[model samples]
Target: MAKYGVHQLRGIIGDFSRVTHFPNANLTVVHNQSKRLNQSQDLSHIAVALLVSTLMQERFVWMTAKTNGTTYRSKIVRSMEEAFAYIDDYRKTFDTVEEP
Candidate 1:
């Protein structure tokens, strides 16, 4: 079931919140590491492409861009202060949560 549920493209698309007011919420950070991320190195560079796609979702993502091997950084951040200051015009939504 987990495999059936966690499709990347659909997951990213479905998490958008359209009706809620902007939040002054804190963002969560995501950091990733792998072993084969060097240019023309013995290891493959697959995750690098994935990280690039993920980062393009927003800005100021606070990434520690790698100097070698397959490592990636990310965060699920929310700052109404910064959002309103910068990202207000570019509206976005997040994945849905059921009301309690």
Candidate 2:
């Protein structure tokens, strides 16, 4: 039920990539809309580095980054729906906890 604030990256690619964070959900999503096959290692490195620095409990990168062979701890997904499903599942983990 948490709303997400999106941070879009411009001029980096045709479709560009969007980073959205849902603080209340403890989720961070990177939606890579670019179709470009060749993404530089540096860019992937920087993206992963940023994700690693975040305190969010869950991180997801959708689209092209998976094909680029960049190693990251964030879950690589194929679509926004899948990402949302993952977040939903994650939230269920907390639902089992009883309130103090």
Q: What is the lDDT of candidate 1?
A: 0.27
Runs with alpha carbons beyond 4 Å of true place in candidate 2: 1-74, 98-100
Please give, for residues 1-100, the per-residue lDDT of candidate 2 as tens digits.
0142112211121111244444423222232322232242223212222222232312433223454454342244445554455445544543444245
Clashes of each: 11, 0
lDDT against the true structure, each candidate: 0.27, 0.33
Q: Which 10 successive residues of model 1 have the least lDDT summed?
A: 44-53
Looking at candidate 2, the ten consecutive residues that score lowest on lDDT are 7-16
Candidate 1 versus truth, CA RMSD in Å, comes to 15.1
Best by lDDT: 2
